[model samples]
Target: VLTTFDLDEYVHAALRAGASGFLLKDARPDELLAGIRAVAGGDAVIAPALTRRLLDEFARYGSAPTDDPRVDRLTEREREILVAIGRGWTNGEIAARLVLSESTVKTHVGRVLAKTGARDRVQAVIFAYDLGLARPSVR
Candidate 1:
């Protein structure tokens, strides 16, 4: 999505709505084209600088509690995996950190997505943030 709005709320909403990319309207022509192409190619894209700002916003204003029943369905291991995903860890990274095989991580991730009714990894990350299971890390 290309828009002038770059607020965290907008970004989060767009992602939850299945947007594959978010780009400011003022972005350079080449960058805009690249973002479009990336999204068309089935790759997600977010401006790096905007992502940093968005994380800072998340850190400042943490998610509120919700009564979503899906939260109760996760196994402890699945919860941990969700947190890792929220922290932006790749499957390989999560595998190494959790000392699980990549296939195991993938299985857990799929389970988490199914249980939470999330459309994809991005939605899972949002769900993690929404439940306060994950927060932006201080860097």
Candidate 2:
């Protein structure tokens, strides 16, 4: 987890560096605690507002999604899980929605990250968007 106000540039850098959560310094006590717990539980966390802003910024500079050979390595199930991750769904949410066990979802998520060369869940989410597997709706 990273507690910093440098969201503009460092957020992406931190995630790429394998940091699981990014929380602003001004986060409330409850939010900070939750972020830490989420990270400790092997889950990724980012403030919702920051997520939206980051997605919008990325979308502006994003390249047109094309056929990337890396994505071809994923199985159909892995691809689906990657898209779900890109949609900001938790492992529990994915498990419930896909009618699978949480452990199964975790396995698939790990596989997706491995196959795609993503360092973490955030990187996987970025990969999903970059590959056109998922599109972020900036609203």
Report, for every candidate in turn, its global Cα lDDT versus the true structure: 0.83, 0.82
Under the 3 Å rule for N, CA and C atoms, how many clashes does model 2 have?
0
Q: What is the C-alpha RMSD of each candidate to the true structure, in Å?
A: 2.8, 2.4
Expressed as tens digits, the lDDT of each residue in 1-139 for candidate 2 is 5466756678878776777888888789999899888778767788776887788867777667889877889898888999999888899999999999999999999898889888778888888777767777645
* C-alpha lDDT of residue 116 in model 1: 92
Cα lDDT of candidate 2 equals: 0.82
lDDT of 1 by residue, 20-114 (tens): 78888889999988988877764567887688876777667756967778978999999899999999999899999999999999999989989
Highest TM-score scorer: 2
Index of the highest-lDDT prediction: 1
For model 2, the stretches where C-alpha displacement exceeds 4 angstroms are 1-6
The residue pairs that clash in candidate 2, if any, are none
